[model samples]
Each structure stands twice: as structure tokens, then as C-alpha cells.
Target: MLDDTLKTQLKSYLERVTQPFEIVASLNDSESAREMQTLLQDIAAMSDMITLKTDGQDARKPSFSLQRTGTEMSLRFAAIPLGHEFTSLVLALLWVGGHPPKVEPEVIEQIQSLDGDYNFEVYMSLSCHNCPDVVQALSLMAVNNPRVRTVIIDGALYQDEVNAREIMAVPTVYLNGAEFGAGRMNVEEIVAKLDTGAAARDAVKLSAKAPYEVLIVGGGPAGAAAAVYAARKGIRTGVAAERFGGQVNDTLAIENYISVLETDGPKFAAALEAHVKAYDVDIMNLQRADQLVPATHEGGLIEVKLANGGVLKSKTVILSTGARWRNVNVPGEQEYKNKGVAYCPHCDGPLFKGKRVAVIGGGNSGVEAAIDLAGIVAHVTLLEFGDALRADAVLVNKLRSLPNVEIHTSAQTTELTGADGKLNGLNYVDRVSNEAHRIELEGVFVQIGLVPNTEWLKGVVELSKHGEIIVDARGQTSVPGVFAAGDVTTVPFKQIVIAAGDGAKAALGAFDHLMRMPA
Candidate 1:
């Protein structure tokens, strides 16, 4: 199961282990068990500090635990952590073996200071790009705090448990057998959820901070670029984001990003964060801005209010709060969300393996989702409200070649139908014929475009008909000293490169505005 290239990488990473650790595997007599044994043996052979033990009595086969020598610090994996989660597995090993993590000292302290025991069980899929963040977070907490325990379960491998818990989403987390959260979450976000007083404390600290010369909201490609450009100008730059990466976190593949041949969303997001961190930009993650207030006077500071009762004042503000996946908003869509209706095919496609599903929309994302689902699902029914597919010719041709896929143009999704707390089918209408129809399916993937994250800015700035912030060529909004960029703005293309360029333009525009202000 271990390839030569992977073995070399694993060996190099294991060299950072300062403490001896043992891999205790609980595997039964099965094909997967043999594969697991081989993988563990390959790992143990790389370092003398590592030992393999098969004495684990865990009921979950093909499961393993990494335990530090002469200590109780440990974490478990009930599935083979490969694909996107392979990095998570390596990080857990390094962390458990005494290699220091790359996190802020304060964050480490917070995790170690947690009061209660947290036994976290996270169900994930190998194809899910979002699962690694959550798995790595809980694993880091477990490695840091002996009171905390984490078990990363592969939903595909543990189908019985997944069905029993009615889990229909990837990276579905459970704490003490109760559902905690489902989706991409970092360590800081997890800590904030557990520590009841952390928000209030954070709010007080944030409110006391000095005003910034350039403050960027949201942490997608646009926000990151703006932060870099502003910090380069020797100005006080700050970024307050609900979560860094925004919609980019949900993206699976990116072959169009300039300068780079190919890369995934998480990798790109990480690089963006690292680049911004290299500058003087002060990044505040897990911070949500609910309101934006313009400056009253010519030189007054603009006030941005946070959801945690914290208000940040800035000399100039850059709004880059990127867009989110547009929902169908049809009946039963919300009620069956995660139960049958999912927006992210990359993360949730495996849940419907061998089951019939429908892909709503006929754009690039929708067509790509249908193609991706065709490989895993039994049958894919694609519905497009338009007369023809809006995807590129290449993608449309590829999708048409799939034998298990069917396309229906001029089809508008009317409602999602389900039974027993699960999605069972969906209703649609033939726009050209003015006739309604229904199709039976276990899952529905909504691939509609994006809705700008400018709802909070409503009544605050001039917006386009689609709710996008109207900006000039220099990226200045109607409100002076307030600039917008990326998907939230009136930019034509929502590509990453376009967003980055617009972000830089907005930063320069803000700087120009600052230069003209009275001292």
C-alpha cells in the first residue's frame, strides 16, 4: 500500500520526531487489515523511535492509535487516513511524537487549559477537502491536552455507524456522542466553541486595539491580497474574518490559477495565509463582522461591529467578504440539507455512492459536479433552468460522454421531497413546456452560482441589482474610504486571479484616499 515516493516523504517527516511513539493497531483478519498492517510496518521501519503493536483491543478494525512513550497523550484513526487527510495523519504523528506544532503560543495555551474532557468523533471521507482541517484541529487539541481525545472515523469505512447516527455530511463532528458541528473548522474556532468566556474575552481585547490604517474584512483571495498590499505600505493593516479562506475552502480543484501549474483550494488558502502572515498584517480569525459604519467626518475612523459585541475602528476599510454557494431555496431543500440536499459535491458525493442523485444547475460547477458524481453515484440527473448548458464546451462534452448521466435543459427545481427525515426525491418543471415533473433520488447537489456576502452592507453602500458592492475602476465604493473587491464587488469574473488583482487595486485606492486625508 505504501509507494516509494510516499515512503521517502514519510521517512523525512518522521525525522522530526523527538519522542518515541508506538502505533497500536486493532485490526481483524481482513483484506483491509492486511493493507493496514503493511502500511504500519512501512512506517515503523523508517524510524527506530517508532514501534508497531497489534495488541489494541479496539472494536473498530483497521483502526490504530498513536501513543507517546511513557505518556498518556494519544489520538486514534478508525480509517486509513489517505488522500486529503494524509497530511492530517502526518501532523498527528509529528505532534504526538513531541514535534512542536506551528500555532500561536496563546492558542496552544488555550487548548491545554481547557477544563472538561472532550471525546470527539469526526466522520469524514477521503475525498473531502474540508475534513482535514477539522481532523487536524481535534488531533492537535488531543495531542496538546491529555483530557481531550479524538477519533477520526472514515464514514465510508464505518457505514453502519454513519447510518445509525443519520450522518449525511462529511466532517460531521460529535462531542460526547452529540452532534457538535459539520463543516470546515479550524482550531481557534473549535476552542471558541468550547470555551464559553472566550468570546467575551476576545471582544474586550479586540475593542481595546488601536485603529488600523487599512482593515480588510473576509479572508479569501481578495482579502489576503489586500492585506499583503496594505502591509507593504508600512501602514497598520488588519484582517478580521469569520474564517480565513472563505468560499475558497470549499473549492476542490484549481487548474487555472496563474504562475502555479495546479493546486487545490486548501493549499492555495494556506499559501495566502502564509504570505499575509509574512507581512506586518495583524490577522484576527473566527471574527465575524455584522455591521459596517461609515466615518462621520472627513478624517474620522470607520467603525465595524463584530458579532461578539466588539467594534473595530479603521481609517480605511476594504470589504472582501467573498461569496457563498447559492441555494435552490425550494421547499424541503433546507429541511433536507445534509440529509439529502448538499451544495458541495466534493465533500458529500461519497455519501450517495450507488444511489441516484440530481445535480441542479448547468454551469461549470454544476456540470463538473455531475461528472464527479457520475463516478460514484448510480445515476446522475442534471437539471438546468436555461435552454442550454452554461459550462464550457469541453466540460459539457465530457459530461455528455458519461453513460450514467442524463441532462434536462429548461428544468427548474421546484421542491425537494423527502421522507423520514431524509431526502427521497425532487420536483422540477419544464420551463419551455410549462409542465412539472419529479424524479426519485437519494441526494441533490445544488450548484447554482454565488451570492455576494454584502448583506450586512445593505443600506450602507450603493449595491448592484445582484447585491454586489458597486465599485469604481480603482475599487472604491460609493462610501468614501470604504472599498470593496472580489466576489463581493462588481467585478466581472469571480476567478481567483481576478480577485487578487482587484484586491491590490482596492488596497492602493484606500492608500490614495488616506494620503489625501487631513493629518
Candidate 2:
């Protein structure tokens, strides 16, 4: 399915291969096997060093294993690698054949210490950008350990299995038959679970007793920044975040975050966590706060109740719970989700390197995505349901300057079409002409809006009609001793730089609030 341009790119990647590599493809005379066989053959043709091995090990379940020129690495994918995951397939081939992944030695020790065989079932979609990191991490660990077995299942291809498990999101990890983890998690997180004997997620907790002087909620840039600032003050500070890095974890290409010229979501998230760990802040990771226990007395303490039967007490609290991506809930969108429908352009753009793609909601984010994808993909079609784009003049101008970009305002997307568990095209309606249109594209990126993660604080604190916490210039909310920052507040803009500044302001406000209390 690779075009001439994509072939050229793959050829360049294969040029770096020095050792011989072999692909042991186990498939039956099925349609998926036929498609996978052709795809793997094409990949082998790109490099004289790569060879394909076909045999019927288990025709019921498709499996592909990659080994060194003459040696076996024991790394394999039990399914076809298509859509956005094509990049991951290529990377894994290169890593196993040429350069081995450079994982931390401490991590290697943890993996070596792990006993007993654990089978991991990771649910993913083709267009899911974040799934590859976790998948690759598990593959690397499996290559290092004999007992760490993994099965990568495409959610769209196996909808029945997904429905049976009640799986609603991508990157959902299942250890054995029960759900283990959801959303984005790295290697250290999985290793942490192994260390604690925690079979599933949600059993992990922080200190339930002892009230901290300052408590920060949320784990995005704003919350992380606040915790760093507060912890630097040499006071008892703790941050209770559902997931550290907030919306920043799902975002891509943060070029406007001050000195950094360019960076992706996962890289920036790791840096944020590393920066926070350098201090003495008690980071309560993986704990979702359900309700806030308000203090009645002047010197009484407040409690932060969590969903996992854990509670935290504090004298002051800062809310930095960030936002989530706005999804386009259309037909076949949920079905083909990672197959060809995607949310983050930066993470999955490379998968559609030489393929045609579309961007929905031609606002600032849509325009930005078009600009980003245009540089990588063959063409970009941007759709907007409004009369005109609501973006900065510079962004629109840059988008227009792109040669492979087409913008269509007043265009309402009707449905996403797919076949063979992958997306192939999309349908839209022209508002002005009142006519329907269809376009053949490999991927679709939804970049419309941001939904704040503030539903858990509804009745506890004063919130705006849109559910964002109303805060003043000092980042103080309606409730005393409580502050909010970042996208979760009624801030003017949701930029990373703005959120980081607001976090610092909220930290200062919380510190000031605590100093006035009895010591």
C-alpha cells in the first residue's frame, strides 16, 4: 500500500541496517494473512538485508516475529501493523536488526527481578499515536525477559473482544482477563505494578494520614509547575493528580514553550515528571480525587477524597486538572478509531508519511495540524463547519502558503468510512452549495476543542457555567484556601506558557494563604 514517496522513505530507513534480519510470519489462508503477507513482502523488497519466513504455526491467530540476521531476538507482533502503527513496525524492525533500544540499567534490573510468566493483552487502534510507545516498551521488555509475553490486538479488527471487555478507550492494558491499566503508561509504570504485586490499576495509593500544608491538584504543566514552585519553598507540599502532564500528554509539537524549539507530548511529559521528582514534593500519581472535604473550623484541616478508597488532607489546595481532546462522535469514528481516525497529529502524522489525510475543525488547532501534517504527508484537507476560520492571522497565512493544503470552511463532516478494519475515506456536506462530497484519505485528525477535567469538583467549589473553576487575578477561587490554574480555570487562553505562568501564580497564592494560618 506504500506509494513511491513512502517507498523511498522506507528505503532510506533500511539503508541504516547492517545485520541480516528475518521475519517469521505465521498465517493461514485468510484475508488478513494475505494482506499482511503482501505488506511484509513489500517491506522486505525495500532492503536486501530483510527476508520473510512463512509457516503455519497458528493460522487462527496471526503472528510475525523479527530476528537478527542469524540470531533470534524473540520480538514479535501478533497482528497486522497498518495505518498509523506502520511507523512502529518499521522502528521495531530497525531496532532489532541494527541498534538495540537503550533502556536504563535500573529498569533492566527490575525486569530481571520479575518472576513468573505474565501475558499482556494491549488493546490498540491504527491511528492511536500513544499506543505505540507502550507497545514498543512491552516488546523491548519481552525481548529482555523470557516470561514477559505480549499480544497486540487491534481494537477495530476485534470489536467483539473489545465489547466483551467493556473497553471504551485506546491503550487499554489487560493482564490475564481483567483490565490492568487504561490511557497512556510507560515502562516504569508497568514495572512499578510488578514491584508492588498490584495485579490491576486503582489499588495504588499515597499517604492517607497527615495533613500537608499545601496540596496541589492536577498533573499538567500548570500543576507540575505549581508543585515545583511550592516544594522549592521548603514547606510540606503534595500534588494529587489523576495523571501527571494533564492534556500535555496528548498534545504534540510544543514549539512555543519558551526556550525549547521543538518537542513531542511523551518527551515533554517525561521531562515534567523528572523536574518534579528533583524536589521533595509528594507526587500522588494514579490517584483520582472524587470529592473535596471542606474545613469548618478556622484551623481545621481539609481532606481530598479519592475514587480508590484513599483520602488526602491538606491546609491549602491548588487545582490544575487540565483538559482532554474534543472527539468527533460520528459513525464509524469509534469503530475505526485508531485504524484511520486519529486525534493527535504530531504522534501519528509520520504513519501517514506519504498518504492523503484530512483535518476536521479548521480553527487554530486544525490549521496548526494542517501545517504540521503538510510537511510530512502527501496532502492535507482541512474542514471547518464555520463560515470562516477562527485562528490567528499568522497561522492562516502560513497554512495558505503550504502547497499541499486545501481549506474548506462551512464543511460539516457527516461520516467516516472504513473497510477491513481500517479507514479509507470520509464524507462531508458543503453548507453553501448544500451538496454532499466524499474524499479518499488514509487518516482523519480531529482538533476542534478542549474539555476541561473539572467534573470532579462540581459541587465542592464555585465553577463557571462551562464547568471551569472561576478564579481571580491571584488564582484564588470562590472558596478560601483553594486556588486553581491552567486550562481548568477561567483563564483567557489555554497555551502551555500561559498555563505554566498561571501555575506559578497559583503556587504563590497557596503559599501566601498558608503563611497566614497558625504555625
User: TM-score for each prediction?
Assistant: 0.99, 0.69
lDDT of each: 0.93, 0.80
Off by over 4 Å in 2: 1-132, 143-145, 150-183, 188-207, 330-332, 350-356, 374-379, 393-405, 414-442
Kindly report which residue pairs in candidate 1 clash with one another: none
lDDT of each residue in 205-248, candidate 1, tens digit only: 99999999999999999999999999999999999998888788
Q: Which ten residues in a row have the lowest lDDT in candidate 1?
A: 66-75
True-structure RMSD, every candidate: 1.0, 8.2
Tell me the TM-score of model 1. Answer: 0.99
Error of 1 at 50 (Å): 1.2
